[model samples]
Target: MSVAPVLEKCRAEGRAALIGYLPVGFPTVEGSIAAMRVLVDSGVDIIEIGVPYSDPVMDGPVIQDAAVRALAVGVRLSDIFTAAEAVAGAGAGALVMTYWNPVLRYGVERFATDLAAAGGAGLITPDLIPDEAGDWIAAADRHDLDKVFLVAPSSTPERLEAVTAQCRGFVYATAVMGVTGARASVGEAAGALVSRTREHTDLPVCVGLGVSDGDQAAEVGRFADGVIVGSALVRCLTEAATPAEGLTALGVLARDLAAGVGRGRS
Candidate 1:
């Protein structure tokens, strides 16, 4: 399904949807694909496939470790698109999240085209500011790819307005001041951040960062249209000895989180 329609469905249900992230080639290309399939089968609404970069500034230790392992296995931008294609071919909606440096290295227009051809629905570059998004946004728009933007608690009202305007698929509402990981509670700060973003745009808001476990997922789900679990999921994959074992663990966790969101809505 298209990004907008999928988000619309989630909103109509009053339950936040699950968006899972896993660094490509974490275990291996094959392992990543298997994990994605399991996630989809476990009822993930959307999948964010991370493109491994040498320097991932926004990622925490878990994701950083995953990226290091992926890079060691020679996972490049091209390999990420290949894995995305495999996921898309399986009838899953996939989004490619990467650093701008890799896209520039691969050529922005070429990367967008390749991503679209691989059935990617959108692109997310956390470090790409709106002021400098002209070329990348234009390229993504040329290929009908949704350009997802991030809004942190640190953003000013004006900056939030600008980000909301540029965002297409959905706005990723970062719940904490630091990198991605699990937290005990989302707290009032996160709720206020979500409320502030809602004042600017009607786009579906998906809360990420510091969300781990079913309870936190449910908490964010109570206030946002979607909940993104990254570091926690990555931790599961990294701890598993085999890809199959990782997939099983992730699928069970996903289902539990999904159940939490469902219960929250009810």
Candidate 2:
């Protein structure tokens, strides 16, 4: 269930992979699953099921709002596995994006066990750095799940090497300096950050933070191996008046982003 294969397939196809993000239990668990299915059907290759956390330091207003709503409705940790199962069922790589605290509270080994059983590809821990990820490393390895870590523009050369060495799936290159949100521009710093990350690891380097539209996806895809989107996709559902309208908006944006990635290399 490693995401490496799907990314490799996209490489073989001469395009960057489109990775979408959605919080489980938003507008209800079933609705979230339907949104994810729409994303996959519209051309997303990998889906990051955001485990609604109380303190999401890396998320922006859009994602934070969605997570708040999800938590308010009592989204349990078990809901993550269910969402992962649905994403896998839809034929997309399913990855859980959660803070380290949740995994530790749920028992790291147990979380990995359930995720793998649910057919999940891996875990993306934003706050857990490689140096502090010993427990997660062992658990993910034991369960055969990929461990995705992040590297920002501020990462020193030594830091990049150390972090990327421990990563199993892909290295996340956080393009923006602040929290996650759709920006007017993905910025000049993102491409350079990705270039720096590539020097340290052979794993696909995916750019996230400040990416929302197809044109931006194309820009990032031109250099990075994948385009990671969250805020904008979440916004489609957050801004919609009804579930059906949200799904419609999600599909249209997903397709646009997919088309954007397709034009990356051309």
Top model number, lDDT: 2
Task: Tell me the TM-score of each prediction against the true structure.
Answer: 0.97, 0.99
- Model 2: per-residue Cα lDDT over 62-181, one tens digit each: 999999999998989999999999999999999999998999999988999999999999999999998999999999999989999999989999999999999998998899899999
Worst ten-residue run, lDDT, model 1? 1-10
Per-residue error for 235 in candidate 1, Å, reads: 0.8
For 173-237, candidate 1 gives per-residue lDDT tens digits of 89889987777777777889999999999988888998888888888889888889898888889
Q: Candidate 2: where is the Cα deviation over 4 Å?
A: none
Best by TM-score: 2
Task: List where candidate 1 sits over 4 angstroms from the true fold.
Answer: none
Candidate 1, position 37, lDDT? 82
Clashing pairs in 1: none
